[model samples]
Target: MDNYLEDNMAKILLAGESWISTTTEFKGYDSFTSTKLEIGCTELLESLKKLGHLVTHIRAHDVPEDFPWSKEALDEYDVILLSDIGSNSFNLSNHVFSEGRPTTNRLELLKQWVLSGGSLMMAGGYLSFSGFEGKAHYSGTPIEDVLPVLIKPYDDRVEVPQGALPEIAVDSQITNGLGKFPEILGYQTVTPKKDAQILMTVDSSPLLVNRTVGKGRTIAYMTDIAPHWASQDFMAWENYGEFFSRCIKWLNKDLD
Candidate 1:
């Protein structure tokens, strides 16, 4: 591991990035259905783990129930990452949905936590930051206020099947030594906040952005860490692990 990363080990809580799919097959007059579970951040997880960072992943289905609802619970980790997940998971808990009881507003708690010195990051995907059909729906939410970018109203995704290469919009420690970025298939369209720094861009839009919130900081990486958006070239890049490890160090305030 690079000395830069070896000294900045952090406890990271990764939420979302997993999904269940159901498919039905038809043969003549008969039909069969099967369900499969998939996780999208295997490469990212492995990279972080290799750097000696402790990562806890909460799958999409388990987010509503398992996500921390209190500041102390949240403070256990140095950073929290929301990936391919919507606000609904944090909004609608089992108590509210099933028992018709009120629960702690996790989103609001997250906002306060960040302001009080917690680090946060949101990665892009189908269910992330005003995602497909606006289903990810982080727009106008408390989380949106803390993020480095403004989430657009509906369907913020910009699908570029031809591949959109990301460029360093500004020089920063997070991007310093990293060479040219490989092309990404797609990314969300977001506007950088007035005080935020646009570290990376794709198609002239913000791809990686960062800002300080009170005593803490937040990052918005508006592209998937996995395939379909993160191209094979991007994933297979020699500096893939180094790049993300640097991001973690930056988020944890280990990088000056």
Candidate 2:
């Protein structure tokens, strides 16, 4: 176990990407309903795990209650990944919303954590980066203040059923050896923050943006790491895992 905690390994906290859904089905004059549980970041998680990074996944509903609210607790992770989760998860905790107790704001803690030398990454989804109908709602959160890109106030997802290929926008050591990527189905549209580096683009929108925040770093990938937006073809691409590994290394400043 000691070997697993080596300096080369990055500890990552991956929040969100898990959800529960209920569906109603009709057969002639009768109706039936079923509930299902799903996770969207399996591929991305597995990829990171395979690269020897330690990952702790906190589902969407579990975030408000489970996310660390203290800097001491937050120190356990070198990187925090907010994927497909909305702002409410950080703003409203069960202690405040259900138990009638005041609690520290997790989002504020996260912002401070990043500023004081922790890496942060936001991967896109329906509930990420000003998601569907603007329901993801991170525009006004403290998180938005540290992000490398500005989230549009309205719904930012651009559906591309026909697929859109990512174009390399900058030549940097972080993106070295990365070749042609597979076309993705869709992506969230975001403007790169001033002084932020636009690493990649899809159509006219920023696809991957990065910037340094104090001693730490922040990266925003404006597309899903899983399906619906990231197609099966994209996930199955030869460089899929390698690409993500590179991003993680870049965030940790381990890549040259």
Candidate 3:
């Protein structure tokens, strides 16, 4: 582990990774239903926190209102992690979609922020990177231009019930000291863009990719940070915390 990572803290805004679902039950033609709220980034969040980083999570439902819409507001954080959230959340704020009020375009702001030296990372999920049935819909957004990979036009998730292992594609500080990675259950399918550096892969497909945008940096991890994809063994890996910490350092150019 790098001592610098332990001594220095990076402020990170982690958005999404939460959802609500409802189920209905029937008894003698009468129906009852229940709704539950679930979060998916607990392990990742804990891992980053343990590495001495300050992370503030913003749920998907609150993004339209909570996400920073100006460069000044965004300056508070060094990095932004978008996990399991769609463009719509940032594009259609409550003020605009519901109340017909004018609001800043957060996605465009985020793109400019990255161009001006803020780091950004996008982790995979059903609501990430042209996710399930293409509902995530980041295909033509400004964010797409800043990403290191090109998103597919349709649902990009690839399920691996038998588990898939990652293959190192490039030698870099982020990969230093990294041993065998635990198998993952699934990941998104994306093509690395020109000039983008692929750090890792799963069965020949890109698993982690990154690139520089203007003075900043951006990275894409094509798998969930926690279960349904990350698997129990992955979350419990001995180097989980170190791996994420190194990723942050690399994205911030601290390891360069």
Candidate 4:
């Protein structure tokens, strides 16, 4: 790891699905056909700034027919975020795959990029991991093979009965400082792989999770990284920043 990452600033890819959050608008699909930079990027960047990082954001909002896969476009950052961006933005875009699968070069670059020791954070949303109606399925994608846990083939909604208290699934340095059942406002749930050291859980399923792939690392957030939870936490609790900061530090900690 670089010392500058600990100093005043570090490069970060504050990426998210650059599109509208469609639920019932796209004929039953949370249509990712028109992704946009997630509005939460501002808030997340603000949070990252508190830790001292020069953040850059990438919007895969519009996928032109001649889109190019450039590690130069993504790999230089200290961390890459796959927040709410489903299969369309990275895999199904133009020149990426003719049939919703990543081509060899793109896949190779991504593999090498991570294997060469890049940091990646995978967060969930309606369009993220096995998202709504399986429209953004990952079980069959090349990304699945690189990741430790295989997402389900369908939506794994983190549904809790109204007034239900959010629960912690496992112990980790990530959720170490927070109080018990600290009242997370909202989140998604996934049947994370047993190999994944479950960090938090809702009902026996994983919430915040971590796993390693080659020389790089991966983390999964079963929730939106924005206002719904962020705002709610600010309005209702005190340790939200601590929770979030732990996640970021986990992703970009110095390995030397």
Tens-place lDDT digits, model 4, residues 1-256: 1112335544766555456563334656454354333455555565656667666665546433322367675566767667766666655554445556546354456557776777667776777778777766766776665665678887766644342354666656776657854444556656666666676665555677787777877777776665454345443455555566667667666421
Ranking of candidates on lDDT, top first: 1, 3, 2, 4
- Candidate 3 Cα misplacement greater than 4 A, ranges: 1-7, 27-31
Number of clashes in every candidate structure? 0, 0, 0, 7
Model 2, 11-119: lDDT tens digits are 8888998899999999999999999979888887777777788888888888887888799988998888889999988888878889888889888888898999988
Off by over 4 Å in 4: 1-10, 17-38, 60-68, 96-108, 161-164, 180-186, 227-231, 234-237
Count clashing residue pairs in model 2: 0
**Against the true structure, whose TM-score is highest?**
1
Across 1-104, the per-residue lDDT of candidate 3 in tens digits comes to: 01113347788888999999999999987999999978777777778878888788888878878888789989988888899999999988878999998878
For each candidate, the alpha-carbon lDDT, in order, equals 0.90, 0.86, 0.88, 0.61
Error of 2 at 130 (Å): 0.7
Per-model C-alpha RMSD = 3.3, 2.6, 3.6, 6.5
Comparing candidate 3 with candidate 4, which one achieves the higher TM-score? 3
Which one wins by TM-score: 2 or 4?
2
The CA lDDT at 176 in model 1 is 89
Clashing pairs in 2: none
lDDT of 3: 0.88
- Tell how far residue 57 is off in model 2, in angstroms: 0.8
Which candidate wins on lDDT? 1
Per residue, candidate 1 scores C-alpha lDDT tens digits across 107-130 of 999999999999999999999999
